[model samples]
Target chain A: MNNTLATIDTPAALIERSRMQRNIARMQQRMNELGVRFRPHVKTSKCIAVAKAQRDGGAQGITVSTLKEAEQFFAEGFTDILYAVGMAPHRLQHAMDLRRRGCALGILTDGVESARAIVEFGRANGEVFDVLIEVDTDGHRSGIRPEEDALLEVAHVLHDGGMRLGGVMTHAGSSYELDTPEALRAMAEQERSGCVRAAQRLRDAGLSCPVVSVGSTPTALMAEALEGVTEVRAGVYVFFDLVMRNIGVCTEDDIALSVLTTVIGHQADKGWAIVDSGWMAMSRDRGTQKQKRDFGYGQVCSVDGTVLDGYVLSGANQEHGILSREGAPDTGIAARFPIGTRLRILPNHACATGAQFPEYQALSEDGSLETWGRFHGW
Target chain B: MNNTLATIDTPAALIERSRMQRNIARMQQRMNELGVRFRPHVKTSKCIAVAKAQRDGGAQGITVSTLKEAEQFFAEGFTDILYAVGMAPHRLQHAMDLRRRGCALGILTDGVESARAIVEFGRANGEVFDVLIEVDTDGHRSGIRPEEDALLEVAHVLHDGGMRLGGVMTHAGSSYELDTPEALRAMAEQERSGCVRAAQRLRDAGLSCPVVSVGSTPTALMAEALEGVTEVRAGVYVFFDLVMRNIGVCTEDDIALSVLTTVIGHQADKGWAIVDSGWMAMSRDRGTQKQKRDFGYGQVCSVDGTVLDGYVLSGANQEHGILSREGAPDTGIAARFPIGTRLRILPNHACATGAQFPEYQALSEDGSLETWGRFHGW
Candidate 1:
């Protein structure tokens, strides 16, 4: 029996299969055109089936934000995994265990202190761990600057300590703040060059440097060249959201994920139709708040995915979302979105919103739905 | 093999059991003094163990935001439960199923349409559901105004249709925005009076109105009196957070929930020591952003739960949190909180943070930790 939108419970995460596939094809094709290997970040969906779909669409290996993701993906036959975040020393043992269990997991580090710890842990356990130095291209979050002396110091520490200094990687996450294609292209080049420069520095210092990787959803889509990059990684592109749409990366038609909700009640005088999908379902990610367009919580859409021009989820409680018009009070809200009316809400951040649900109802073009399990927590 | 602060994994939700018990005891005692039955909203923890502790602290029944919570709690021996959110007509069968299984699950409605659907479904299924009319005291979110004629019309529909019209309830959620005792006391009284007035109107119209309920964490604590209110409900009190702290209801010491994270790396020049806990672990709830005191993602604390006054998680990525001083860039951050330095972050909202993890590490006074399971999703 197929679970259509009408049969499923309220507050369910819905993934449009056609849109998701089109997104996958789009990203994979972009990476291929730029002549770089594509490592789709599984942290966005955290579902094996979605990762398999990416692999089917020409993505090689995978990138993860946590070791737990590596473990989950490795268990599902994805051996080549890169834990993208800087390495926490305590997790070294778990990384070693995973590698010992036939997983080609690559760990990351950005500073000398962490690089030393990884070397020490590898030496004491007689494990030659693959390590990548995180280079800061945009200075948005973690990483060492491309020209920083510490980059070579850390590279030497890993290369000389019997650990495999695999390469250098950078993510221009600040690209999300830029709406212009020129700015995005510049950020992409900056990301590519900075990581390549860090790799060159390590090589110039007599250390082996093989790989150079860089990406962010916006940059990956806008980059005209990937000159010195060997691979590109991106998440959230699998499910374009309002934030991405506002950045001019994808259209509303390309957004693959949305929260299916039922209008339970209303405050007609205030033009508010209360929905069951609140912060618990859509998450509290206000990523679009400072963007070119601020989607209060999400963009309102019909159950079949047509955008409702003036409607938005203006306010949300823990279990109740207040749907209202953009300006004037739609005094006939009760009649318009009557009790038990099912609707879909496109989120501000696909990654955060997708994490709120335990499973997603993958809606196929044939009007059938299949349950896809998603892993949560560390 | 017990997990302590030294042994357990980073980015884990830690609950100070002693403080939780104190919070539970304080709220229950106040409700007792107010001469009303205490029904703690289990939506805060969503953990059976935590709910059991609340029950042991004199809470008579549990209030839930979703039917799933009703199902989970009812399975754990909590027979008297209230589904506090406005009921969607499609969920009528699920509510009837729970009631048929001997779970005295009370449902809510605010408008005539929902009331008529509830009555029709109840009549068709031969189930007399304990129904509560949601009255609006403050114009914050959902519910019908206390003096609105729809209240009586909806009450008559349920009462005449053979379904049990149990009572009237309202949540003064706007109380969370007030930082003064005087304002909170006034809001509490307004909530109490408004809900009681709705019940009076129903009785004057010759309808049976037995219960009157009203509460919000701030109002529950600052109420000068809850005279007409027969019962009260509150959720965040069990695990006080920074938002509650800013509301002047709970102090920093009263907060029971914190995320245990490890400093994985640093950008010393920027005075940023990156930790393993980010928005993914702490949640994207910027609840305190507009408050008098904005604790950027969360307040940073020592591993022993001692609050670090000037430090807070200033910025966060998916799995990386930037720990820095509130006003100044502490240049010695690398040496101060070096790699592997374990710290705890007090979230802006406890309910949002706790939902990010599958299980919480309940820390006892003796320094031992016990994993308490929590349910997620609808």
Candidate 2:
């Protein structure tokens, strides 16, 4: 028996398969036109089906935030995987194990101390680890600046010891804060230049720096050109969320992931229809709170996925979301959304919301639902 | 080799087993003294070991926020469970299935429409669900007011229509906002009296209101007396967090759950030691934002578990937590906590943080760690 939206359980993560495919194609097409290899970050969906679709749409290799993702995707037959987060020493053994198992697993690092640890671990284990020097183009998180002398120093530590100095990678995650095309385009250019510059510096120092990777959904989409960059990587764009929408990267209709929820009860006088999608379901990611338009929890959609204007999740508890109108209290909230009403809530952050679920209910255009399993935790 | 604090992976949820046991004992003792049965809300930990410990410490039953949790706990020999979320009509079939499976699953309802649906579903399925009317004691979330005419109306709807009107239950969730003992005691008394009044109203109207239940971690700990309350229920108290800390119910030392993370890299000039535990590990719940003292993402503690004054997760990305000093950037952060430095972060909400991980590393007093698994989603 095939399950439609009606038959599937509430508080389940739903990926509108058509929208997801379209989102994948849009990014792939842009990457194709830009003349760069597209490595879709598997960290967003973490489901093989979604990663497979991205690959089908012309993704080169998968980029992952955790080694667990590399292991999972590798088991699913993905050979080339990049462990994008700065590699911690303790995880080196796990990374080495994955590489030994035929996973072309590449890890990242930014400092001299970390580089020494990586070299030391590789030397002790009698293995050469493929390492990417994480560059800080935006100064938002971890990474040495592209022009910093430390970049050459870290590269030397990995190269001087027996290790593959893979290349340079930077994520201009600060692009999330920008809304205008100019700011996004600027961020993209900055990201591309910084990463490419690091690669140039490594080469100037007579070292092997082949790969040059850079991205974030905004930078990936708005970049005018990918001049010296070999590849671009992105994750959240596969399921464009409210955060992306606010950043002007994607529209609400472009959002592929939403939590299918049920209107369980209501507080009529308060004009709140309590739904089953709380922080536990929709997630506590209030990514929209600081955005141009704050969708408290999320924007409420009808059962058929049509936008229900003004109705938003005003407040949320563990398993209960209070869905109310944006302005003037939704006086008829009870009658408007009676008990048993199934509603879809577009999440604030797809990655965060997706993590809350053990499996994704991929609803195709024909209303047939397929359970796509995704793993969580390290 | 057994994994300990030094060896276990970073960004892992660590439950201080002794602290958890103490938390359980404290709540159970309070309920025992108040002359009421204690039903620990398992939604916080969701680990069978934690639930078993609660039961072992004198809990009468378990309260669940999801049917999935009820099913999981039931499979683990926890038969007496209360599905505390409002009764959504779409879930009636699932509820009936659980009841028929010999699990004494108690469901909740707050309105006549839902009550009627329950009775209808009950008659059609010929299964009498042990139903409780949720009362809004503190005007926080779900439930009918004690004095509302709908209280008797819904109770009669269940009784007259042939469903078991087991009792009335209310959660003084607003107690989370009050920090002073006077305010908490007032809220606790209010939570107790209102729930008792609602149960009294149902009994006065010739309905069998066998139970009068009420609780919230703050209220449960501060309540001078339970009065007519038959049972007290609370979840976060099992692993009290900063929210409970600020609410004056528990001190920082009482917090049992902490995210064990490692310094992956550093932004020395910015005074940031980027850790592997980001929003992905801690959860994007900025629950402490509106509190008097906002610990950005969480309060940073040493690996050996001592609070580092003026240190908090100033910022967090997907898998990168920017650990920094509160007032000023510690320029010597790189040397102060060099790369690979292990640290533990006490989260704002234990329930939200715990949900981020698939399993917890329960660290004993002797510093040995054991994995305790927990489930997510509907």
> TM-scores for chain B, in order?
0.99, 0.99
Query: Which digits, one per residue and each the tens of the lDDT, describe model 2 over residues A1-378?
Result: 778888788888999999999999999999999999999998889899999999999999999888888888999999999999888898999999998989999999999999999999999999999999999999888899987889999999999998999999999999999999999999999999999999999999999888999999999999999999999999999999999999999999999999999889989999999999899988898889999999999999998889888889889999999999988897898999999889999999999999999999999888889999998888
Give per-residue CA lDDT, model 1, range A73-100, as digits (tens): 9999999999999998999999999999
Q: Report how far off residue B222 is in candidate 2 (Å).
A: 0.7
Per-chain TM-score of chain A in candidate 2 equals 0.99
Second chain TM-score for model 1: 0.99
Query: lDDT scores for all predictions?
Result: 0.93, 0.92
Which candidate number maximizes DockQ? 1
- Cα deviation of B140 in candidate 2 (Å)? 1.6
The deviation in Å at residue A180 for candidate 1 is: 0.8
Q: Please identify model 1 stretches exceeding 4 Å from their true place.
A: none
Error of 1 at B7 (Å): 0.8
lDDT of 2 by residue, B233-284 (tens): 8999989999888878888899999999999999898998999999999999
Each prediction's DockQ? Answer: 0.92, 0.85
With candidate 1 superimposed using the best TM-score fit, by how many Å does residue A202's alpha carbon deviate from the native? 1.5
Where does candidate 2 chain B have its weakest 10-residue lDDT segment?
B198-207
